[model samples]
Target: MDLTIHQNCPSCGAPIELHEADRLIRCPYCEVKNFMVSRGVLRFVLPDRAPENIERSEMFYAPYLRFKGNIYYCKGKHQKYKVVDTTQQGMNARALPPSLGLRPQAMPVSLVTEEIQGTFLRQTVKAKTLLERAALLTVIDSEKIKAPFYHRAYIGESLSCIYLPLYIKDEILYDAVTNKPLASGGSAENMRKSGSGYHPTWTPHFLATLCPQCGDALTGEHDSLILSCHNCHSSWAEQQGKFHSIDWSCVVSAETSMYYLPFWKIRVRSTAFGLETFADFLRITNQPLVIQEKHTEMDLVFWVPSFKLRPSTFLRMGKNITLRQAKIPDGEPKMVQRMHPVTLQRKEAIQSLKSILAGAALNKKKLLPLLPDLSFQPMSTELIYLPFSDKGHDFVQEQTGISLAKSVLHFGRKL
Candidate 1:
């Protein structure tokens, strides 16, 4: 994983050095912050600014992907099936401590977003691999949704590469950022050992706030995934060092003043499982609903919120929507107010959709036997804006008149 990528500072015309481990770098001459981005997997390191009092201390950035999303687990088969549930989960992206018990918890640290300065430990595990390991720990069988599950599971409204500061002093392990002791003796000694060599590097890319296509300054709420370029009349989703064209449509509402909320409307075709229709779902789940011959093969649609909200609330929203009928109306919205930032991207949404379908299918009938295989093919994806009325501390859905508490919205000023 030793990569020597040479780049120049976007702010100043100065050669920027970059090592494989560095995600954010600063220019020594111009003092500009630059971020390292790539289409492939990327790793980031946090700056260590520990106190100078510790006589013997070693600082290094340990990599971890902060995960936030739902976790589903089930065991047994047919009549013996039991213990099926889906709960929100968060996982630390680090190896479990050895028998010495030097477990370090990642806590909040003031990160230098403007300029990061530190030697990063080469990310021995890729984010994708770490996500897989997390899914395995959760006993999830599918792989396609694992990455998305972890990506969406990030505690905050966004996914981040976290590097914790590990300090060793007198054979005692301490969290340098918090100055809290973690473990002593052999565990501390083991953690102090380092094998990854840091090479001299610099940050290459500048954080762009303008539209890459039209060169117009992008306008949107902070951390929003959807950016609009009025010059080109296009909406783009910023993902993985590139701008992707996203299908955006707003619901037509009669209300004069309304805010358009974004939701990932995903249609998926399930194969390798017999639960393909409403009747099949009812039969498999043993629901009391009467089976009708007209209910044949049907595609599963998921309306996942793009903004951050409580896990329970989000799950409820996903279950309340009806597929196929939730299409976004054609034409531009008169005035769409962007509320919270979109935390989930399209790829992650697809992965999450797969997991959601699998979880629903598996947990539907504990008494039913397990399927031989489970797979999903995405039929269509769109970023649909649903109109909502901001009513003081709550939001009322324009179409359905359903009301939601303001606390459910993770971002934006209190209404």
Candidate 2:
């Protein structure tokens, strides 16, 4: 599929085309880089192939919501999940196709700009409705209605509004791009009367990448959610289109290293569960290790990777790191290079809170009932980089015994 999106460089006003996954825009003409920020879900449109006679302003289009994410659901005594990637119509228009099918993967798409004016179909369908439907569409079994599914969460979610080209000719609805007859309305005239036109009000917004504390240029990969400044040794994350400094530290050693992987260190407060201290965790999860007096003073922190990976690997890494969190010491305020991009955000990492808790539990019978009442509210969050010793096949963090396959690192980048 053509996922190339075009945007004008803020420095030189030169048109630059980028992949859909790219957030950092680089302008070749001006040799400047800026980060793109969006307050809501990103938007895109399919390439139009209509005849030249059609007026661009008067044309009609259909809206589809595209969802690509990892799904986690807690049902009965067990937790289940799947990696889902699908799309559905964004409105209740019966005249158009219910789903976008494989069209987005088959062809190219562009960012919907103010330059294109058309009767963009109104998105009356709620995104929550589609999110529920996507899970059922890709199920392990034709799951029967067993009710009372206590928890459901989506992580690493990539939501976008995709517009399909459409038009009316001779009182009949037709796909403007493929010229195939569509199922929308009995006739073209009926669709125009029934369908409400949507006015384009939002455009993609970009921000200059500069350190808030120091007058230094921020550096990060194309899809990085966290950008850092080497001069000031500061890290930044975006919240509602604004960049904010993050509480970050690095476990630096005197020896040379290859790369540092970022992780989210989260401390959660629960009114129903006693999860504040390491002693509480030992009792809750029923660990074999003896709980010492020091364990009560040590606060428990959930360590989640700040990058995407396969579901199994993601869960394993999170569970293992969290279990040995006490082994990690207070880090130094130092700058580091050769780091993996933070593809996953703090919001997405929090979705795995329950899943990681469930995974860490030794006795499900005791923990299952508590899962319904347990509410994990993040009291504090910090970004930390851990040094890993590179083996030929895997990278090992000797302090915590956290080992990640080199192959897994390469595979995660694609996700």
Candidate 3:
């Protein structure tokens, strides 16, 4: 059964819509608050367990000898299965206008055969590779993982989309001169009342009391969770949930904010060719294969795998620096090295390695047309307030987005 009630907030005596799971309610009218009952009496559905004795296999795509396109299939089920990348885009020459304040000149656009072909292969293989990778990583406690279909006869059945809650504390601004904090709070409220006694941090008035710059009160007519100091003109925002500060210091501000972020982890089986096709492909590609280098102790080679399941934008940049030290032959590092390392074998390695080399020369402005095919669903969100103060004059909000999503989108642009 479900329950609902209209109750007055104990702190502000304002009308509030109460639910079985609600522990506290805020009063917009009186700017007060109240406590709700039945916080522990909420109902919930159980999670499904992971499937047992699941069969896995190797997956791959082989380009045809002629113009017949390609072939896709899976290897036999085995205890171990690996992922490989085949996308490749190598560096090439391009015509550019004169530098050093010279006049612009018109020139014909030329296509680089090798770069284009490699980029095309990378785009084509990505969609299928991601699907295969997701299927392989799906091994988890079946009870917690979610699947669309469900039946008692099924060994593992779970909800497909689960809203996992989290806490995030983002600091917008830290005063350079004074040690005072001159920013708005970006934390959840529920977790704040978990304690008793007159806690100074729990109350908004305490943290928002003084301006970080001028050390003035932030009192205002706005009842919204976020407010700005009339003296500094800096504002902040927050939601009603649990939040905590991990570490507070002059360098960084850490706080906890509650939120629901989504993700899907799955496993799958795939196959690959048992033989090598070309050695040049191996040299330019980052695919996993054993290689012998002088003065090197290890004989084995491996690549890390990664996934951007949702829609995303990928931008590559390439730059040639004439180092003072002699350059090593055939030494091109994969861009995935910019992130945490994971297992990437066979085809996945080749593809990721190729993409990195292709865009190694991309500048901040010219992203070219290959910037699409890279996007993902939102993992988390937070409403943050940045602080700014001008000594004698008013301050203006920075030229970026006031929200996190927009800000990320802006910076995620080319380069």
Candidate 4:
């Protein structure tokens, strides 16, 4: 019996057939890509769209809404009410080091701010700031520039930073909102104790750190405390009775921005060759075995930036269009020549990408050959923030609005 499964491109709606050794597959339709699976209890499917909101242009440039550390006034462009920045070249190509004479790069500073306030361990933590993303290399040939040593001047190719916004929801599990953790699980006498601090669990919109020892997942329990491991046997608390390595969460500061980071998916084909020969004195036996190795040319797809062509902050329509269709004004091209786009939730997309990198490291394989091993295909999607303001906006409500708008507008566009 022959087993043939019909598959369609998630982005452009192209018809495709499943192939046995074809781990990485691209759609002929819209260039939306996907991964292949041969067996096992496969879990997790990549989303077709980003789950967060684009702010629908409601978040205007308001001095009253700005925080002290915002990079907006000095760094970004103000378009109407929204703060805007556009990329003229492909981020992938810009990743190349200018010092190496690979490509030209631009490094921009950040501007935006928000106030963060919350209680962790009965103590109040208050601060005002914006979020920023690390400066990264944007290369034209993502496949060629795998190592940093190849780049010339690192400064030019790297991006400055983006200050994005996030929402945080918290829950208190203690016996009383005013009582300390000792009071919740302690004797009645503990309730009368003085100078006791309340214990609360904090859940942030995005995750930034992980436990190094067991690779167990972690979450911020409070402004100062972190719930490191979900496994009970795991050691989360240090000698100081606090989670270790949690200070790393500071990486996602208010200066963080949504960027058009570039990446390359590579494909390599190889064959085996030659044979081992042995010489013996008695009863010489002859063996016939020849090894052959064939290396196939690498195929690549550069991950590029995706923006709605409409004036609206959200994507309104299109089932099919050319490569020039879904882009922001004066947008840049991806560094890599060929690429497959996949639409995935922000969280899942990052996770899947990380998994590919990690798996490649452990398996001693290059990413180019591991393209087919990826769980989801690539898509042009935005990495955006829910944007929170202690003064006016509720992140929850904003996220809900964004989700509703995306579902309605995703499939309604023209190519």
Candidate lDDT values, in order: 0.49, 0.79, 0.22, 0.22
What lDDT does candidate 2 reach at residue 184?
Answer: 44
TM per prediction = 0.61, 0.92, 0.18, 0.16
Count of backbone clashes, every candidate in sequence: 10, 5, 55, 62
For 130-183, candidate 2 gives per-residue lDDT tens digits of: 887877753544265353465667888788899888876665677887888776
Best by lDDT: 2
Write the residue-wise lDDT of candidate 1 on 26-137 in tens digits: 6778965543444332333433446786442246555555433444333332111111111111223233221111121222232223244333444455455544554565
Pick by lDDT: 1 or 2, better one = 2
For model 2, the stretches where C-alpha displacement exceeds 4 angstroms are 137-148, 183-190, 193-201
| RMSD (Å) per prediction | 9.2, 2.4, 28.0, 28.5
TM-score winner between candidates 3 and 4 = 3
lDDT of 2: 0.79
The residue-by-residue lDDT of candidate 4 on 238-339, one tens digit each, is 322223431111111132231111122212121211111111100011112222131111111222112212222221111111111112122222122111
Model 3 per-residue lDDT tens digits across residues 1-415: 1123444445654656543223334567865433222221121111112122211111101110001011111111111112221111111101111110110011111111111111110112233343433343333313233332111010011111001111112432211112233333232222222312222221222122344456655332211222234454443222233222111101111222211111111111111221122222233333244543431232112111121211112211101111100121221111110111111112332333223323231231222122232212222222222211222232211221111232322232211
Work out how many backbone clashes candidate 1 has.
10
Candidate 1 residues lying further than 4 Å off, grouped into runs, are 1-66, 74-161, 164-194, 197-204, 271-300, 323-335, 338-340, 354-363, 366-372, 411-415
